[model samples]
Target: MNDTSTTPEAGAAGSVRPTLAAVARLAGVSNSTASLAFSGTGPVSDATRERVLSAAKELNYAGPDPRARSLRRGRSGIVGVVMEERVGDAFRDPIKIALLDGISDEIAVIDAGLLILTDAGEAAQRIEDAPMDAVVLIGCSPRLDESVAMLRQRGIPLVAIEGDPADDVLTIAQDNREATRVAAQHLADLGHTDVSVVTLSLTRDRARGPLTDERLAAGSSNTTLERLSGVRDVFPDAGGYVTRGSFVEEGRIAGHALLDDPDDRPTAIIAQSDLLAAGVIRAAEEVGLAVPADLSVVGFDGVRVDGLWPYDLTTLVQPAIDKGRAAGVAIVEMLEGGVAHPATFTSVFHLGNTTAAPRAH
Candidate 1:
């Protein structure tokens, strides 16, 4: 407010850098006195404090770094996100991106950074070693046991989204089995007597091959298993092809493998991801088939698509982003010693443009 006291150099640099001495000199006091005025850790008249702040403004100075205050408070002020996928890929997916955004909002109250810990394309072993005040597992990663063990051992707070066996870990859960079962029943109701599935992979090995019962029994990803169980609940004999990840390419590959042989093909297909469903749709086109008319397609994770063809995906619209944000809140609460337990989230069924009755032909 004091134009006469203000110097033009304050705006010259990109950022204002006012020293304690500068604030003190302007306030007509010693540097220590100015420091005391700013910190309030030492006694200072209210009027003196106001004067020092005014001098800081005349020099266009921002108050002391919050980082310094946080450091002195003995808080690491960091929340770690442990995802098995690449950061770029994770951000690209709308579901994961939304979740991260939500988590950021929750962590803001604590003034914490969301540190992303990727195994650098490694496995669960590396997940444990990340420097974090707490850990949130983003999606269904392959190394749950090792990852969980490490986090628990270090006494780092932990939360998982769609993790296995419904353990005591803080989790945002989904009705994966029940949700997929709804989708499967929809297909069966459509008179899809012979239906098959395109499933997300069960292991980190990520092999592109037909799914075997043995592997299914030992499957690690809880989401994958629950979805598979849902399918089996309807068409007990339904066949499926499992791939390494929940990407479009994997769905396309699984789609081609499942749909290429017309004589043996099922009239309906359930892909566990929107990307995979898109891929499966692509595979159908390459074989000269019409969506819903020749083949009915359904996918999970009600996501949006721009360049996808033929139809909007029929799917279960799970709140992926909300799940991530909830995990962040849980972690922060646990770290702050406020909350004492984990969280579980659920998904809803969303019917879109992708499913139809099997052609009587």
Candidate 2:
């Protein structure tokens, strides 16, 4: 008989998978000691740790199964990130991408995986039933009160970005009202009395049309409402067109409608998003109007637009990544049995070439 034939093959298809118990037995240690050596949560002697690792290698034991560890800790080690819009649509925005990057960076440290859930199609049910340790709701609407209630019932730690869904949830709020107010006032100082606005969606229905008094009263999105109010603070009667989303095409549609009437066209336009601003710019060019010379346009959210050179967009530079990181830190604190407080971030005005005094006819 060959001695090599008698030796157990490590990780062979037919070989039995080694367990922590077998590793501990080979290392002459208790099961608890082996667990501590792997988890690093409890103290273990250096010599013992080395012995356990050496034994685990010989036995082909890959420490403990993550599933079993999660079960033992009573946590799934997964964080659910819920968005109000479809994942595909949400990903198109640079702000959303930067926010997600910040969130992923913070959560990676705790060995928690992210499970993205959107409140659309069949995935909406996951908002209430997902096996996650905590959840972060990004750009959620006040209309999601029922969903928030369900998540709360399930005992999931909740953090909301820029929405007031509930009083108990840790909120990472933005200074939407003040920032837009400042932007509007900038145009006002430049003698732009005939200014119009291009707004984001006001309701879940995403009805695109003029922002009527009735529609403004029934607005469900906190961000849209806040920014709208900010514009109203400067231009009380500044009428605007509501869009389905913060999309360029929607802004272009709004721009054409607002600019079609040359006699009644606004001297300036305040777009709620940078993408919308870019569309408004394109619409101006389509009508043979030069930016800042014939029409002055201002936008919010200082996101870099590809192919938008020769025009530095004058917008409010909000701390998008920092907002996401704040939310992530809040989630970590809550999950670690610590209290987390709500955070509010403000935006800085970035002066660029897109804005100037309205051209005299």
> TM-scores of the models, in the given order?
0.76, 0.81
Report the lDDT tens digits of candidate 1 across residue range 1-361: 5654334335547364445555566788654345556544334689999998998788776554446645776555556676666665665566766676667656655545556666555544556765557777765555566667767888887777765622667778778888889999999887888988888778656566887888777777767888989999998988889987767878889999998887988899988888889989989999998997899999888887656855878888888767766776787788778974566656677777778888887
Q: Write the per-residue lDDT of candidate 2 for residues 1-361, one digit (tens) a residue.
A: 5334213434455375555555556787754456556755334689999998998888666664458657778887677788877666776778887776667556544545557787776778878887788999998886678889998898999999897668888899999999999999999999899889999988877889998899998888889989988999999998989998878888899999888887888889999999999999989989988999888888888998876789999999999988988988888889889889898999999999988898876
Candidate 2 stretches greater than 4 Å from native:
1-66
lDDT of each: 0.73, 0.82
Which consecutive 10 residues in model 1 have the weakest lDDT in total?
3-12
Best by TM-score: 2
lDDT (Cα, 0-100) at 11 in candidate 2: 46
Range of the 10 consecutive residues with the lowest summed lDDT in candidate 2: 2-11
